[model samples]
Target: VAVTIPVSDDPTLPCLTFRFWVLATIFSILAAAVGAFNFLRYNQIALTTFAFILMSYPCGLLMAKILPSWKIGFYWPSDFLFARGTFIGGSLNPGPFNVKEQTLIIVAASTNLGAAYALDILSIQRLFFGPNQNPNNVGWAASLLLLWTTQCLGYSMAGLSRSWLVYPAAMWWPTNLVTANLLHIFHSDLQQEVVRDRLAVFKKITVLALVYELLPQFFAGYLSRISLVCLALGGASGKLGIAADYSPGRGTGVGIVTLDWAGVSQLGPLYTPLWAQMNVLISLMVSSWIFTPLLYVSDFWNAKSYPITSTGTFDNEFRPYDVSRVIDLQTHDLVVAKYDAYSPLMLNPAWAIVYAAGFAALSATLVHVFLFHGQELAEGFRSSRNPESEDVHVKMMRKYPEVPFTWYLATLVIFAALSIFLVEYWNTEFGMRWWGVLLAIAMAFIFLIPTGIILAISNATIGTNIIVELIYGFIDPGKAIANTVFKTYGFNSLHQAHALASDLKLGVYMKIPPKAMFISQFYGTIIGSIVNYAVMDMLIRNVKQIWYFTHHSPLAIDNHWNAQNPPVFYTASLIWGAIGPQRFFSGQYSVLYYGFLVGAIAPVLTWGLHRRFPGSGWNYVNFPIFFQYWGKAQSNGFANCLVSGFAASLTSQFWLKRHHRTWYDKYNYTVSAGLDSGSMFTAIIIYLV
Candidate 1:
């Protein structure tokens, strides 16, 4: 903590001042709009929190310079003839744009950095399923309620887990450390030689990255993924028998390399721990290069008959399954006779392994956290209750009043009730009972701490989407809406909770008031949710060709707005909801069921091995990360950036950390922030131009 985050406090600094509110609100709206707009694009660009951090500083300083310092007051007039008014006044601009104000603005904007997860549920529903596939049929009230409830429920969970997740120094979120460090550099005394040097480096890198991005992103796109093996084999469609094996654009991307920082930094090589990166690389090598190739060559599950990598489900004849044929038009459920007469659902080898890996990753997270970090978590929980055991950062934060527990509790209750009401009252459309809401919440709550622990330390997360789909699939099979709604509530709530927790820890590090942090995040979430729904509605209604499954549009040319996510989402609904996991996981896919058991056992064995050989670095082999990344390439497409990612990780984390400690400490995170900011800026510019 001392090495990464400054141990200091200046309580008098203005946090929720007039300038802060104006900037926060503006950035919050912008972030939401940008996030939602890019979500449907083929090459999706996340307007990352680093971008928020970089952009907000200048805007805050500009506002501080331009806005008047004169006091502005709110007045309410009395009804009497001799009227009197109650007045509240504050300066238009706060003293100076301090760290607290900057932190609040960043937090607010960052909260809405991506489109709401519930939008996926809405997209799949409107684009692919049922009579309501038409955007006009989807009700605004129901959509808003679904979006807001799922987005907010996690705030409650985040509040409930704050003691263990945020206050404890042991649960240090690695990602936030980068944010904190960059913010400190931005706000530090520029007069200092060291600070000036660091800032210069940051600026130079940002410009260099921006200029370099154009080469790969535009002029020579082939520079993004250069595969020597593919060239050696002749080409993407070479006459060589195994030409597809090394084609990064169409195949598994074995031995592919990327010169683009945007591609290399996708997995956060500079920031994520070396062990975590290694685990992912090891898993990728074994699964994509070795295991998947072996399976494809052997025609495992008749893999050679279909594309080596595809998210779309296939029919027995090896074509894209025509979902409309098996689904009833009116009821929207699977027509048993049609499905039986048609053919069983088929998955490519890679996609099948992706599901199996997802199952293992989820179960492995629970067991891993239980066996390894269980004791530390217990202590943190107890320490949270007893404030005397607080660390320096938490101790410093005690001067400011904390957000009351009841605030989160009340918010949780209100949203939870609204969720239940929507599902039950609109059961015809949602296809979920009130109990399903409860079940979804229960699942989110169960995995919160376990997943939080992994994310905090490793900068890697294990999602509950697969497990939630599987469990709910069995409980309420043949209802696509129910599966999607349940998955949204279950998966998104947990995800949002962790996002809140991460920001809260950032607040702790920065000494921002807990109440101010809560307000910023809560407000951002509401604003983002509204903007997300509005954008989704507009796109669905106006776009001539949105999804390829329904129709193709010019926007899909060169994969601009091809609508990749919705198809994958729609496929999961069919596999897990309409066809039912019970049927889909039977016969040929029965081996997938063992994934859960394998996931559970792998962690136990690792834990035992660590105990037996404490010095062997056994503890660093996180099974959850390994399993999660094992089949990541199948869903994420070819391993186009794997070589570059590994190179960056080793260069920064291994070589620089050991050989050039001083330069690494002062400039590593700044470089990361600059590169990300530059790449994002370039992408946004490219889109607009």
Candidate 2:
């Protein structure tokens, strides 16, 4: 619902108009849960998931190209014309699109997508592992039962307070899953193997040293006060646009923090991005193109650190080039060839760094091997390119020793200063004639500082949009920038208006060809923007009276889903710290630095916690919701807990399971993309209709 227009007479029809659909989603969830369970147990092939993946590229490309080609553009002079990313929990007033209905549909689709993931993992095992391995061994039936039971409880509760269905907190299930993955990785057997080696002893010691020094710092202000401060700033500065006049009988609409179900939906479209399609494509293309090559380079160092084997995959063993085979002990036709592993130590660090520089390069390599490379290796054995026949160029890149810690710190300071300057530039709207562009460039540094630091530190990745949006808004608050400085007489908004330019720069650091990345991302964003806007407008228009902000309405978009509100809370906090009014503690400016602190130090913390007290994994695995005791009234506590357990257990089992190896292994990549693309497609379809 975009803007809630009230209708007091009809109690059943709120402004959102789709509350009934959300209620109906309970059935969809049930069906999906059952389907997912059956698919996982039986190792079923889901054409739906595969089709989505295969079609993603073509659809995105076509959509991007068609609109521009036909010049059938939905131009918005205002800043409200952005694209919706995933529909389930997007912002409400995302420019011109309010797509709450489509968002719910995507949420339903995601439930099914989860099922696809379960089954896909099994399919992988079946393809790669021998047929005898049990795909059903992962306790699929039990998982489904748990999911169903918890969902039932949630639905019953929602029925009692029907307004709880559309809140953002209600969508915490996915975030929990992400947190669970981090927890599992932190305590996985894989890390145990790394620590066992004599050569890696120094690495372990370094990790330990860092953890001890950083843990207290991490907890001190980084996790607690920084986030809260930012949220508060965003809320207080009117940056979030959440009404502050909630004094009873005094014309203060209810505070956003206290907004009801439909109210929270206003924030939905913030989840939308102009470049989602492009981002997905870039992620995939880089993974397939650049990351794959980096993985090959990784083998030079890693291939030799471990033994060389010929028969088994990385899951069963981490050995390089398996070559052993037993033929019933009769003919003994099996070949026993020995190949030497590459030694990365002999390679130049410069070369190694170049090879390893990509988003999630290491994780991508490992995941690709775990799910995909294994099958490719198997295929190589069966093909004409035998080990004895050809000199294959298969090498996994070694881990690059990063630049010294000092370099990252310097960058952080520089960026923070820059971000501050950008804010000043943006303040020109309030009569500060300070150069906006320079300030924007400077502020961009603040974000870049920690983004690089944490990313380089523990390889921890987090969203960078908070800084991006604030800076963009500050630098170019208007919808357009009329300047000839950056190449042409360019006209683009400070934020999404310059998406092409910003992404072009990002693509450069990530090793993507500037032109291709620019084109792909721009194409995807524009196309997605139109469709997202159209669908959102339609849904909001149809449900206008239901979602507006009013006393009688069950849900209101203004206080809840608007982009200028919730996220603004954080932006304001950052600005306050830089300015020093609300900045009480010494670490006020250090808030952005926390991103680096958290990302860099997380691995060490996890390791130390595990060492000091084993089984800390299970406890720490439940990520506490910071600040708020009860997140947006719509959130289901049980659902998040259930999803966390399910994601971890299921992911772990897929890694361990022998059967359905092919499917199980490829689950992560396929499912992430599949759901994203499927929902995008559904959104477009809705727009078209």
Candidate 3:
């Protein structure tokens, strides 16, 4: 039963506004490329994350006016918006811009962030500044190509046999639904019958939001900081003060009245579905809100001396710890005498517990996959071998000749071979071995299917960095660079694979050409890699004291880009490379290792209960996902987000979705777009001023 939607007798696809789209896309790339380079030098990562779609909103509005008057093409802005069911339209609907190219440009812009991030953590952070005694001496060419190839090799695999994960509607990647609707909101036909005035609603909301934002963002911004506790106890966070450092973000309990939505979302506020948000918030309440406070108050792991919400390593005397000074220059191992003189690598009680829980999470992910997806995996592979006789998405896709699996094989081999070549040939101070590189790739391949399955079901993908770190930790204990590079390959490659797979699904639904999709993903990644490195390099050379101050620095307490995720990568390099996991996980912190067993068994037990009582609701409990969301960040990272994020989730995912499905679907993505666009645009202005 191959049900297909018949198209009208049209020769070729409509080129609504070709010139404007080209110009808009070029401007977007140029803006992101140049802005990411110059702006992120002084500003935080947030400034560079300006949503292209948000930028598109204003541009599309502008084009609607200009394209009609210009008298350029055959269809001079006749039907400004196309009712493709995937995009939204407006008054004039805009001529030059359409949905297909919109996806391409946004996808291209997205490609910038990952490569910069990975390289910054692995090579750039060390080679230029801190930690590594003898930094990697590889030139620009070597670094750029290496990063580009890895992303390409892994991502290309997703294109070859994407049917199983994509075709089945059951594997509804909920995030994409949100994205599709957002695109629909952007490219939708305003004159259509189903529901008109959607664009008007977007405009109304956006204007109101922008006007309201002006108050908190610029004039009398004190409204943004409406916490009573912080106002009351302005200056008393001393050791014995009753304030207990109970400032809004500084102290414990939930920071209420922090009403800045963009500040809260910073990265993922708008897009994260209510379901995933609820799960994460529940875990945060358990971990950070309730448990963390208790542990900190009790002075667990010398919490009294350290900030309650950080992963900063502390000395036994509660002084901040640094690994660079502790490493022996010749041996790359910790000097035992100095280490003995120093305090053991200690963390805030909150993060210490998370490390343990993270281990449990890794095992839990594997176990949950086996329990839930084991049967489906076999069936999916068998069915996908030929796209034989199932879902209409599969049958429809069967029309286009699939990219040969051997191409995927060749891609993986070629790029991976290049990666290994960089390691063996460059042989820089990183000390990455050939075997270690292969093992990382092997690890990525091993987990890709299961993790991909997990990501497809629920848009959340639990990172396996800890597992990869643990593996290489044992292999090259004293080699920080090796361990970091290994983890990047193992974890990030699959991370990229997930991205490509999702894009493929997006292309499928949108009916974009597969070959075109592959070209965009593969080449977009290469461009992104080059631009990311170029941006990172320029910023590093230009900015002074701009690099991330490690946990050891007193200045790291500030809420800046440096205090964010990069430090975690640096810490892993030190912990896994400098100190070695054996000394921590298997020795002094031996309890962390057992987390794997705890994780493995718990899910198995849950599965047994599900089998025992079919209707007992055991199946609904995703304990693995629960554990995966259990980890927290250092202070200023997710601390502020938890409380506000919880409330927002409850409002959106729970109350609104349950009560007002029609309204929620119609307006959710639009509201999100307004917030993201308004805030980002405002933030950029704020930076410029």
Best by TM-score: 1
- Model 2 lDDT per residue over 1-689, tens place: 11111111111211122221332243344335434333322122232322322333233334334432221224334345575333232222222111222222222322333332112222222222222333332233322222222122221122111111111111111222221222122222454443133223323433443343232222232221122222666654232211232221111111222111112212211121112212222332333224323433466434333321111122113432222231112211221121113211122211222222322222232332233224333433352433332211110101212223354345334433443343354332112233543443343333322222222211223233333333343343321111111101011112221222222222222222222332233233323323322333343335433233312256554332221221222222222211122211122222333433333333444445656788555212211111011111112211112212223334433333355655433233223332333333333343344
Ranking by lDDT: 1, 3, 2
Better of 1 and 3 by TM-score: 1
For model 1, residues 370-484, the per-residue Cα lDDT tens digits are 8998776677656344555355798888899999989999988899999999998887778899999999999999999889988888888887888899899999899887898
The backbone clash count of each candidate, in order, is 0, 82, 13
Local lDDT at 270 for model 1 = 92
Better of 2 and 3 by TM-score: 3
TM-score of 1: 0.93
lDDT (Cα atoms) of all candidates against the true structure: 0.82, 0.26, 0.62
Off by over 4 Å in 2: 1-440, 446-460, 463-514, 523-668, 671-689
Per-prediction TM-score to the true structure, in the order listed: 0.93, 0.27, 0.82
- Comparing 1 and 3 on lDDT, the stronger one: 1
Scored by lDDT, the top model is 1
What clash count does candidate 2 reach?
82
* TM-score computed on alpha carbons, candidate 3: 0.82
